[model samples]
Target: MSQNNAIYKGFKVSAKVRQAPDAFPGGDVVHPRFLATVTITQVSTGMGSQRLLPPEIQQFADAPHAAITLALTSAREAIDGMSTFVKAK
Candidate 1:
């Protein structure tokens, strides 16, 4: 697993890359797939954290860096208010 963090539009965007689970129940991962996750947190006081993307194995990238990039982009959209992610309680 790899993690990266950045501050964007007063929101803290944290992203991480994780390897997807094996396709078969007891088989090796023939082609490893990397999945990414993004968590967006409000930097201001009295704000809560929000998960921009779920860490599902169904969505993956060919490379770890690519996965991280994908996660960050999604977080950026949410932080920019372009996404429908819930802002506050």
Candidate 2:
């Protein structure tokens, strides 16, 4: 989306899995790690468009990266929890 239409802007975080040397001897190598990348982008009209529009439109700009990261984490956790719950059922 374009900047004008963006309600907020923040970074984009991601997770990466790769092989790395284990600090201990004769230990299982490799592990998964989440790497957060600070990518500045405009929050689309879909995030909180309704509440952020009209009277609150003027306040939209350079949103905090931490807030976006937390939201992403929460969403991921919710999805994971749902998957686990479904699998158990």
Candidate 3:
């Protein structure tokens, strides 16, 4: 992690979900995939922004909103745990 006067703008988390439309009589439901992304940027340039990605989750819930919430929660945890800094190159 590099503290290059980026001014710790903020962070964000997003998730994508999918549902199968076809089933033969009865089929095991496919779980949605939850992804969490944390972005840190500077207020000035917004360039060189860093993105923190958590391991792709198997599922958060049966719906998109729930999955998003869960992903965000995970992001929060990750953010809370961030404390490292990079030396100037």
Candidate 4:
């Protein structure tokens, strides 16, 4: 089966992207504009599924890979920041 998600820093990240609506009148929809979504959940949560950050939405006009990559980067940064907070206090 194909993998649509990745485990990173003990967090599960799944991505979904939608094609952009038709740019021209009655023209074919293009991927030049995509709505990207990334959901991050802890790998092991004592309490039911715990999400570090709420579902994030990103607008991209590039390839899905680029969008996913950006989403992952944002997730990692958020996770790292959260880790710092937890460790600081």
Number of clashing residue pairs in every model?
0, 1, 1, 0
In model 4, the runs with Cα more than 4 Å from the true position are: 1-3, 22-31, 46-52, 84-89
Q: Between 1 and 3, whose TM-score is larger?
A: 1
TM-score of each: 0.65, 0.25, 0.41, 0.62
TM-score of the candidate numbered 4? 0.62
Per residue, candidate 1 scores C-alpha lDDT tens digits across 1-89 of: 88888888766778778897747587755687888878776674324544343332223688889988887887675556545455454
What's the lDDT of the predicted structure labeled candidate 4? 0.63
lDDT of 1 at 35: 85
Which segments of candidate 2 are over 4 A away from where they belong? 1-63, 84-89
State the lDDT of candidate 3 residue by residue for 15-49, as single tens digits: 44444233334775555433322333223323454
Ranking the candidates on lDDT from highest down gives: 1, 4, 3, 2
> Which predicted model would earn the best TM-score?
1
Q: By TM-score, highest first, what's the ranking?
A: 1, 4, 3, 2
Residue 44 in candidate 2, Cα distance off native in Å = 21
RMSD list, candidates in order: 5.6, 15.8, 9.2, 4.7
Better of 3 and 4 by lDDT: 4
Better of 2 and 4 by TM-score: 4
Candidate 3's C-alpha runs over 4 A off are 1-9, 20-27, 30-59, 84-89
